[model samples]
Target: MEYTEGVVKDKETVIHVHPNDYEKAGNSYLMAIVAVIAGMPLPIINLIASGVYYLGNLKASYFVRWHCIQAILAQTIIIPFNSIAWGWTLSVMLNKTEPTLYYGIYLFAVILLNIIEFVAVINTASRVNKGENVRWIIIAPLTDKLCSKKNKSPYPLY
Candidate 1:
C-alpha cells in the first residue's frame, strides 16, 4: 500500500492518496472505458473488468481502492440502462418490432445518461492522473462505504 493523506478541501471527503498511486487509480477509469468499448454489446463487461481490477488491487492503498470501487460502482449503474437499450435495439432490428414513442424517449434518456457517465469518467480519469481526486455525487458515498476508511486498511473487513 502506498499513500499519504490530504484534505479534499470539501466537506464531502478527506482523500488518502499518493502521487505514485495516482496513475494506477486513474488508469482504472480508462480501463473501464476500454472494457465498455471492447464489449459494446455486453454491458456487463465493464463491470466485470472493474471487479477484476479491484480484486487484483485488494492490497492497494486506500486511494487506489477508493477509485477502483468508485469506477466499478459507476459501471454497475450503467449496466442495466445500457442492457435495456441494447436489448430493445436488438428486438427492434431482429424482431421487426414497431418502435413506439416511448421507445424513442427512452433511447434519448439512455443516451443522455450514457453521455453524462462518459464525461464524468473521462474527467475523473484525467484528474486522478494529475493527483487530483474527484468524488462523484452518488457513487463516491457508495464507494466510501465499500472501501475501508482507515489508511492501513485497503478493503473493509478483509
Candidate 2:
C-alpha cells in the first residue's frame, strides 16, 4: 500500500490505496462505459450499471467504494439526461419538425458532454490504477460525503 496525494490533496482529503487493487477498484468505471454503450438507443443501461455498483459492492474497501460510489452517482445524473435527450429527439421525429438551431446546439452539447465524461473516466481510472487519488469536480464532494457516512472498510492487499 502507498499514500499518494489526491488530485486536490492540498484542499481535499487524501485517500490511500494499494497499487494492485487500484485497477480493480477502477473496474466500476469500465463497467459504466460498457453499460452506457450497450444500452445505447435506450437510456436504462446506466441505471443498471449504477445499481450493480451500489448494491453489489457494499463490502468493498473504502478506496474502491469511493470510486464506485462516484461512478454510480455520475451515472445517475447522466442516465436521466440521456433519456430526456432521446425523448426530445423522438418528439421531434414524431412531429415531423425540421431540425432547428436549438436541436443542433443540443446535439453538440450532448456529444461534448459524452466526450468529456469518457475522457475524465479514462484518465481517472488510469491514475487510480497507479495508486493515485483522482477526483471528479462535480462528484467529489458527494463521493466524500457518502463514503464518509458509510462504514469505512479497511484497504485490502489484494
Candidate 3:
C-alpha cells in the first residue's frame, strides 16, 4: 500500500510538472514569433513613407510646400529612429534579454528629434499663415531663380 501510494504521488507530480513546462515552452515560442513579426514591419513602413513624402514634396504646389516640407522632415528624422527603436526592443524581448542603456539613449534621441521637429513645424506654419516666406524652413535653400516672381510678367500688359 505504501509503495503504490508513493508511485501515484510521484506520477501526479510529474504530470503537473510536464504541463507547466509545456505552457512555458508554448509561451516562449509565441512571444518569439510575435516579436519578429512586429519588429520587421516598422523599418519597411518608415522607408516607404519617407521615400513617398520626399518624392511628393519635390513637385508640391506653392500653397502646399510648407505642409509637404513638414511631412518630409518628420519622415526623414522621426520615422527612421522610431522604427529602429521598435526593432531593437523587439529583438531584445525576443532574445529574452533586458534592454540596455543604449535603448534609453535611442529613446532620448527620438524625443529630442521630435521636439526639434515640432518647433520647426510650428515655426513654418506660423510664418506661412502670416504671409511670410517659408523657403528657409525647408532643408534645401530656395533660390530666387525658382521663385514664381521671376517666371511671370510684373505687369498684366498681355
TM-score of each: 0.83, 0.78, 0.45
Root mean square deviation (Cα) for candidate 1: 4.0
Task: For each of the candidates, give the backbone clash count.
Answer: 0, 0, 0
lDDT of 1 at 61: 73
Q: Model 3: how large is the Cα RMSD against the reference?
A: 29.5
**Residue-wise lDDT of candidate 2 within 21-134, one digit each (tens)?**
577667777777787678778777866886687567776666777778888787777776677778888888899667789887987888788788888877877777776667
- Specify the highest-TM-score model's number: 1
Encode model 3's per-residue lDDT on 12-82: one tens digit a residue: 23111122222222221132223334654454553354345435434333223333433444445556676
lDDT of 3: 0.43
lDDT of 1 by residue, 1-158 (tens): 52345324435665655566788899889888898779878888989999999898878877788889999998998889999998998999887888899889999999999888888899999998888878988888788789885655444322
lDDT of 2 at 38: 85
Ranking by lDDT: 1, 2, 3
**What's model 3's TM-score?**
0.45
